[model samples]
Target: MTYFKVLFFTLCFLAFTTHAKEQPLKLDKHLSVFQPYLGSWQADFDVAPGTKPVQDVGLWERALNGKAIRTKHSINEGEYGGESMIFYDSKKDSLVFYYFTTAGFYTKGTIKVLSPTQFVAYEEVTGSKEGITKVKSTSDLKDGKLVVSTSYLKKGEWTKPESRIYTRSNQAVKFK
Candidate 1:
């Protein structure tokens, strides 16, 4: 009887271990990538001379059937950025990005996360001096700073996009 009991317990443990290993990753279908982005952000931009350097404030949230992340960014240098969508598609396992800017640009792309703190999204421009536009966004905690990036691109024969890094400079006020 003791031998049979030990055998049953061992089998049960092995079954549980196997099941845990095969568990599917869970994604919040109701949460767009934007939900993770909701918060105050500080931006430091690199600008050319004769053009004053720029910095800004921004807000983000989820939208569109809980399928996209949207951002509304404002600058102190007399320019305003409009809302944009960042969608995560589980079927293709990629982040679909789309944005229409008042500055006269409509761009789209897919985002691949290389790590929890690093990702790059890119697609092409369709009209009027067409080129591939890529944006690399990376975030990390450093001395409690929240950093992100929206890198620029000038596609010439499919060159890779550059990276942008943003660091949190102020105390984060939770709005949950």
Candidate 2:
């Protein structure tokens, strides 16, 4: 009788583990707009004209049992880095994200999906002493490349937008 009981328990454990392994990821349907960006990408661009180009590497992946999307990026081989986690907020009925940087600042933002290939983000900066209080960015994926443009609000004035184009890459994001 003891042997039979042990066998039954083992079979139950096996069944449970198998079910767990086969469970599907629960990503929110709203996140489908970001599907094309779910890989590593690299971009080289000057922060300002006439300056040396900085190399930025970024990686995007699903997180928190697919409830959120996590993005990690580094500039100039880890001279600067940041991580962002984006998830759907049921109360707000929108997708929101929090970004934390190595520079002792962070931003909270909302994303609006305009189309299958385009989205925009508006962020409120906190803990920045450089007088930057707001930021807006738009990303569009086209022809296997991603184009991102950003504008910064500094000291109550909005700056001109700058754009960058990124291509799929195999480089890993690193932090110093």
User: TM-score for all predictions?
Assistant: 0.56, 0.82
Tell me the deviation in Å of residue 176 in model 1: 29
Among all windows of ten consecutive residues in candidate 2, which has the lowest summed lDDT? 23-32
Best by TM-score: 2
- Summarize candidate 1's per-residue lDDT along 52-165 as a digit string, tens digits: 877765665545545566766666633755456776667877777677654666677777665544455565554424454544455543453555544455564434433334
Mark the regions of model 2 whose C-alpha exceeds 4 Å error after superposition.
Answer: 1-26, 47-51
What pairs collide in candidate 2? none
Q: Cα deviation of 17 in candidate 1 (Å)?
A: 43
lDDT of 2 by residue, 1-176 (tens): 99999999999999999998894454668776677788899999867787767999999998887789999999998999999999999999999999999999999999999988999999999998898999999999999999999999999999999899999999999999
Residue 22 displacement in candidate 2 (angstroms): 11
Candidate 2 achieves a global lDDT of 0.92
What lDDT does the true structure give each of the candidates? 0.57, 0.92
- Cα-based lDDT at residue 80, candidate 2: 90
